[model samples]
Target: MNFRLFSQLSSYHADIKRLIKIALPILLAQIAQNSMGLVDTIMAGRVSATDMAAISVGASIWLPLVLFGHGLLLALPPTVSYLNGSGQQHRIAHQIRQGIWIALASCIPLGILIYYSDFALRFMQMEPHMAHIAQDYLHAMLWGLPAYLLLMNFRCLNDGIAKTKPAMVITFLGLMLNIPLNYIFIYGKLGIPAFGAVGCGIATAIVNWSMCLMMIGYSYFNRQERKLQVFSQIIEKPNAATLKKLLQLGLPIAIALCCEVALFAITALLLSPLGANIVASHQIALNTSSLIFMFPMSIGMATTILVGQALGAGAPEKAKKLSYAALLLGLTLTVVTAFITIFYRYQIAAIFVTDEIVIGMAATLLFLAAIYQFSDTVQVVVGGVLRGYKDTKVILYITLFSYWVIGIPLGYVLARTDLLMPSIGAQGFWLAFVVSLTFAAVLLFYRMRKTQSLSDDVLMARLEKLK
Candidate 1:
C-alpha cells in the first residue's frame, strides 16, 4: 500500500510538471490577449469615465456574441488532439479545412448581430452619448471579426498539436503592436482623426487582421503544419456530414460559454444606469479578475490537450490522473492569485482609473472577486477535462443552470430589488458570481468523478466514437 501510494504521488508530480510546460505559453498568450482589454480600460479611462464606460458597454455587447462564435471553433482543438493521440493524423487536415468553413460561416451572422448593437445599447437604457460611443466601438470591431475567427481556427490547430508557442509569440507581437496603434488612433496621431474610446476597437480590429495574417503565414511555413497538410486543399468543398459533426460538438460549447459571458454582459448593462462611476468601477474589478483568471484558464486549456492526448493514446487511466493533477494545480494557482487580489485590490483598481469613488468601489468588488477564485478555477478546469472526454453537454446544461437560473436571478434580486435586502448594486453581481460558480464547481467535480469511474469497456466505447 505504501509503495503504491508513493508511485501514484510520483506520477502526479510528473504530470503537473508536464501540464505547466503546456500551460505556461498558453497563460502568457492569454495574458497578452486580455491585456489589450486592460490597455483599453486604462487608455480610455484617461479620456473620461464615460469613455471607459463606453468601452465597457461596447465590450458587453460584442464580446459574448463574438465568443459565441469563438466557442464553436473551440471544438476543433480537442477533436484534433484526439485524432493526433489516436494516430489519425491523416484526417486532421480535412477537419481543419472544414473548421475554416465553420469560421467563415460564423462571421456573417456574428457581424450582423454586432452591427445592430445600438438596439442592445438602447435596451440597456444608457445615456445617449455613452450609447453612441458604444455603438461606434462595436462598428469599428466588425472589420476584425473574420480575421479573429480565422485566427482562432489556426490557434486551435496549433494548440491541438501542442504547438502553443507560435500563438504566444504572435499574440505578444500583436499586443506590442496594439499599444502604438491605440496611441495613434486614440490620440489621433499620424494624420489619423482621434476616435477616443472608439479607437480601441479600431486598433484591436487592425491587430486582429494582422495576427490572423501572421498566423496564416506561420501555418504555411510551419514544419508540423506542412506535414499535417492543413492547407493543402484550401478549396475543398465542405462536407455536410463533417460540418454537422463539428456543429453538434461545437454548438453546446458555444451556448455554454455565451450563457456565462452573457451574465457578465447583462450585469454590465444593468449597472449602466447607475452612472459611469459605477460602471467603470465594475469594469476595473472585472478586468482585474479576468487578467488573473488567465492562469487557471490556461491550465484548463492545457488539460484539454493533455487529457485528450492521453486518452487518444489509449490511456484512460492516465487521462483521469491528468485531470486530477490539473485540478490540483489550478486550485493552487488560484490561492496565490486570490491572495494577490486581496492585498493589492486598491492599487490594482488605481491602475485603471483615478476617480476616488471608482477606486474605492472597485477595491470592494475586487475583494468579492477574490472570494470566488477557488470555485471559478475548479469549474473551469473541470470543464476543460470533461471536454477531453467529449462530455460537453453536461457542461452546457450545468453552466446554463448555474449562471442563468441560479446566479442571475439571485443577483438581480440582490442588486436591483429590496426583496432580499437593500440593493447592493454591482457588489450583488460579484456575490452572485461566487454562488453560481460554487454550484458549478460542485456539480462539475461530481461529473468528472463519474467520468473517471467509467469502466474500461465503457471508456473504450467513448474513444471508438472519435473514429
Candidate 2:
C-alpha cells in the first residue's frame, strides 16, 4: 500500500512538472504584457494626479471597448486548439481566416463606438479638461483596433498550436518598444512635441501594429507554421459555417468579459461621487491587483490550451490531470505573491502615487486582495479548463451568480452601509470581491469535474464501440 501511494504521488508530481513546462513561459509572457500597462499607469501617475486621472478616465473609456473586441476574438484560440488536436491543420487555417473576417466585421462598429467615447465622457460628468485629455487619448488609441484584434487572433492561433514562445518573444519586444515610445511621446524628447497622456495612446497604437505585423511575419517565415496547410490557405474564401461556429463560441466570452468590465466601469462611476482621491486610490489598488492577477491569468490561458488539446485528442483523463496540476501550480505561485503583497502592501502602493490617502486606502485593499488571490487562482484555472471543454455557458452563468447576485449586493451593503456593517468603503468592495471569487472557484471546479466525468463516459462508450 505504501508503494502504491508513493507511485500515485510520483505520477501527480510528474503531471505538475508537465503543467509547469507548458504554463511557465505563457505566464511570463502574460506578465510582460501586463507590465506594459502597469508601466504606462505608473509613468502617467508621475506627471500629476490630473495625468493619472486622465489615464484612469481614458482607460474607463478604452478598456471596455478593447475587451469587447478581445472577447469576440477569443473564439479563435479554442477553435484552433480543437482543430490542432484533431490533426485538422487545414481547418485551423480556415478558422484563422474566419477569425480575421470576424475581427474586421466587429472593428467598424467598435471603432465608431470608441471614437465617440469622448462625447460619452461628457455625459459621465467628467470635467472639461479631463474629458478633453481622455478624448484625445481615446481617439489616438482607436487607430490600433484593427491591429489589436489581428494580433489577438494570431496570438490565439499560436497558442492553439502549443507554441507560446514566439508570442512571448514578440510581446517582450513590444514592451521594450513601449517604454522608449512612451518616453519620447510623453516628454517630447528626440525633437518630438510632448503629447503627454495623448502620447500614451499613440505609443500603444504603434505597438499594436508592430506586434501584429511581427507575428504575421514570423508565422510566414517559420518552417513549423509554414508546413501547416492553414498557413498555405491564408487567402481562402471565408466559410459561413466556420464563421458561425467562431461567433457561437466567441459571443458568450465576449458578453462575460463585457459584464465584468462593465462592473468595474460602474464601480468607477459610483466612486466618482466619493471624490478624486477615493477614485484615484481605487484605481491604484485595482491596477496593482490586476498586475498580480496576470500570474494566475496566464496559467489559466495555458490551462485552456493544454486542456483543450487533451480533450481534442480524446484524453479526458489527461485533461483532468492537467487541470488539477495547473490549479495546484497557480495556487502555489499566487500564495507566494499574496504573502509578498501582504508584507509589503504599503510599499507597493507607494510606487503608484504620492497621495497619503491613496496609499493608505490601497494598502487596506491589498490585504483583502491577498485573501482573494487563492479564490482568484482557483476560479481562473477552472474557468480555463472549462473553456477548453467548451463548457463556457455554464461558467458564464456561474460568473453572473457570483459577481452580480452575491458580490455586488454584498459590496453595496458593506460599502454603503445600509444593513450589515458601517461603510467600509472600497475595502468593503474588496471583501465582497473575495467572497464572490471563492464561490466562483467552488462552482467552476464542480462543473469541471462533472464535465470530465461525462467526457470519460463518452470515451469508454467509444472504446466499447471499437471493440
Candidate 3:
C-alpha cells in the first residue's frame, strides 16, 4: 500500500510538471495582455480620479465587446489543436484562412457597435463630464477593434497547435510598446498635443495593429510554422461547413463570456448611483482583481488546449488527468495570490486614488476578493477544460444560475435597504461575487467530471461522422 501511494504521488508530480510546461507560456501571454490594460488604468488614474472613472465606465462597455469577439474567435484554437493532434498539417492553413474570414466577419459588426458607443453612453446618464471622458476613450478605442480581432484569431490559431511561444512573444512586444505609447498619447509628451484618454485609444490601436503584423511576419518566417505548413495551403473560398462548425463551437463561448461580463457591467451600473467615489473605488478593486486573474485565466486557456489535444488524440484518461493537474496548479497559485491581496490590501488600494473614502471602500472589497480567489480559480480552469471537451452549453446554464439567480439578487438585497441586512453598498456586491463564484466553481467541476468520463474516441468518431 505504501509503495502504491508513493508511485501514485510520483506520477502526479510528473503530470504536474508536464502541465506547467504547457501552462507557463500561456500564463505569461495572459499576464502581458492584461498588463496592457493595467498600464492604461494606471496611466489614466494618474491623470485624475475622474479619468480613472471614465476609463472604468468605458471599459465596462469596451471589455465585454472585446471579450465577446474574442470568445467567438476562440473556436480557432481548439480546431487547430484537434487538427494538429491528428497530424493534418495541410488542413491547418485552410482552417487559418477560414478563421481569418470569420474573424473579419465578426469584427465588422463589432467595430460598428464600438463606433456608436458614445451614443450609447448618453443613454447611461452618467455625469456630463464623466460621459465626455468616456466618449473620448471609447472613440479612440474603436479603431483598434478590427486589428484586435484579427490578432486574437492569429493568437488562437498559434495557441491551438501548442505553439504558445509566438503568441507570448508578440504579446510581450506589444506590452513593451504599450507603455511608451500610452505615455506619449496620455501625457502628450515629446512636444505633442495632450490627448489624455483619447490618446490611450490611439496608442492601443497602434499596438493592436503592430501585434497583428508582427505575428503574421513571425508565422511566415519561423521555421516551426514553416514545418507545420500553417500558411502553405491556399484556401480560395469560404467553407460554409467549416464556418458553421466554428460558430457552433464559438457562439456558446461568446454567450458564456458575455453572461459573466454582463454581470460585472451591471454591477458597475448599479454602483454608479452610489456616487463617483464608490464607482471609482469599485473600478480600482475590479482592475486589480482583473490583473491578478490573468494567472489562472492563462492556466485555463492552457488547460483547454492540452485537454482538447489529448481528446483529439483519443486519450480520454490523459485529458482527465491533465485537467485535474491544471486545476490543482491553478488553485495553488490563487491561494498564494489571495494571501498577497489580504496582506497588501490597503497598499494596493492606495495606488488607485488619493481619496480616503475610495481607499477604504476598495480595501474592504479586496478582502472579499481574497476570499473568492479559490472559487474563481476553480470555475475558470474547470470551464476551460470543459470548453476543450466542447461542453459549453451547460456552462451557459451554470453561469446564468450562479450569476443572476444567486449573485445578482443577493447583491441587490445587500447593497440597498431592500432586505434584512443594512446597506453594505459595493461591499455587499463583493460578497455576492464570492457566493456566485463558489457556485460556479462547484457546477463547473461537476460538468468537467462528467465530460471526462466519456470516451474521447467516441466523441471524435461522432465529430468525424458529422463532418
- Model 2: CA > 4 A from native: 42-52, 189-191, 275-281, 353-360, 455-467
Which one is best on lDDT? 1
TM-score of each: 0.92, 0.91, 0.91
TM-score of 2: 0.91
> Which digits, one per residue and each the tens of the lDDT, describe model 3 over residues 41-65?
8898888888887887888788888
Alpha carbon lDDT of each predicted model? 0.90, 0.81, 0.83
Among all candidates shown, the one with the greatest TM-score: 1
Per-residue lDDT over 97-171 for candidate 1, one digit per residue giving the tens place of the 0 to 100 score = 998999999998898899988888888788999999999999999999999999999999999988899999999
Task: Estimate, for each residue in 1-467, the C-alpha lDDT of model 2 and write its tens digit.
Answer: 99999987787788777667667778778888877887787777776667777887888767777888888877776667766776667667777777888888889988998898866887878688878888888888989989989998888888888888888899999999999999998878999998888888899999999999999888788887787754665466777877776776788888888888887777766666667877777877787788888888888888888777776677778888888888888988987999999999999989988888889988898888889999989998898888787667787799989999998888878877759866877777788899999999999889988777775777545322311
Ranking of all predicted structures according to TM-score, beginning with the best and ending with the worst: 1, 2, 3
Better of 1 and 2 by lDDT: 1
